[model samples]
Target: MAVKSKSVASKIVLTALVLVAIFPIFWVFLNSFKQLVDIVSTTPKFIFTPTLDNYIYVLGRDNVQHGLFNSIIIAGLSVLIGAVLGIPAAYAVARYPNRFSDDIQFFVLSLRFLPPVAVAIPLIAIWLDLGLYDTRTALVITYTLLTMSTIIWLAIPAFSRVPREIEEAAIVDGYGPYAVFFKVALPVAAKSLIGAVIFSFILVWNEFLIALMLTTSDAKTLPIIASEFTLLGRNVPWGILNASVIVLSLPPLIFVGVMSGFINSALKKKD
Candidate 1:
């Protein structure tokens, strides 16, 4: 009975920790449903009626359809580039763990540490000179570099965790290196690869800094559009702002929830 009590206590504490971690997301969601008068109210308004007015206003905007389209296009293209580049690169690194491969992994990770703002200046200049400024291609190339580093980082582990003996056995049975990689290694690591790609998609989708600077009116993203609310007058359209934010936030949230479930199921199946 005493041991059972200890386990219960532990569960309670863990539950509290999880709630703390998720509180900010909960706060955003709760406020998104509240009316503007209640959103920043001095007193908490948890008991108030919820409204979809904010969401309707944001989604109903003129350029929003275009922005949404652009976001989907850029994010999808970025994921494709990351998968193409990172998968082979990671497979090579895992298959041959030489100093060069290790250095390559290290170099890929180094890209993350570089500030976006610092890179954006030169990138903007180069894009302008190349006549690629404010174009979808610019977004694609930058997002490729932005997302692929992390995707490669995640892919390397998935590849390395697969036993080399499995690949060797397949190769010995007449399968080529590529066949062994695709037929054996990738099938097993599909869950991790899928999870990593989903994560990369979320990162590119939510990215603001590069998108803000790289894209003007022609190719502005959701995040960039969200920032436009702040430039409004004092009596701002609160409903529209909150509505826009909620919609903007939904894609990544749903992506994580759906992909996480699949990943969990995949891991269970593997077990």
Candidate 2:
């Protein structure tokens, strides 16, 4: 009886935690469909008429569309470039351990520890000198610092998990170091690498501070555009703001949903 009671209590705690976590997102989602009056009403309206005006208003703007496109381009390119560079670097660190290897890994990890403002301040001057300011190219290059560090840090363990024996077997079959990495280690670690890429993508996608400092107009991201809504003093446009929140959230949600199968496989493999 005591064991059963404990199990029930644990389940109750877990369910409560889940509800608490989900409630804010659910509240925003609910409000996105509401009109201004319904959203700000003293009493919550549970059964008010829903409208697509919020969505239409938010999506109709040209800046929102451009910001969305810039976000996609910047996030996608950063992840792609970071993966190409960081994966090989990770494999090298995992497979080839020297006196400096640990130091190198730590240095890479240390980049992530620095606050965004610290990195952005110096980068802003450097970018200005190079005449790359307010360009997507500038953002992509800057964002690689974020994406590459994350990928390398996460992928080191993933690459380490590739069996040494399999690599040796590939060598016996006439595979060179590069071939072994490409053929044996990479294929084995693909699922875990997918997880790492997804994480890096989300990180770069949601990044706002550095982006805000670097870009003025042509390279503004969705988060930057969403922030503009909050600057409206009295009116606030809660409905449009909530609508923008939903819009901002959709890409990451869709990316995760599309990659759910690989994510599940990766988890199962880890298990």
TM-score: which candidate is best? 2
Backbone N/Cα/C clashes per model:
2, 0
What is the C-alpha lDDT profile of model 2 across 1-271, one tens digit per residue? 9999999999999999999998888889989999999999999877889999999989999999999999999999999999999999999999988999989999999998899999889988999999998999999999998999999998988888888999999899899999999989999999888888898999998999999999999999999999998887787899999999999998788776636765575456553
Looking at candidate 2, the ten consecutive residues that score lowest on lDDT are 262-271
For model 1, the superposed segments whose C-alpha errors exceed 4 Å read 1-19, 40-42, 257-271
Cα lDDT for residue 50, candidate 1: 88
Among all candidates shown, the one with the greatest lDDT:
2
TM-score (C-alpha, index-matched) for candidate 1: 0.85
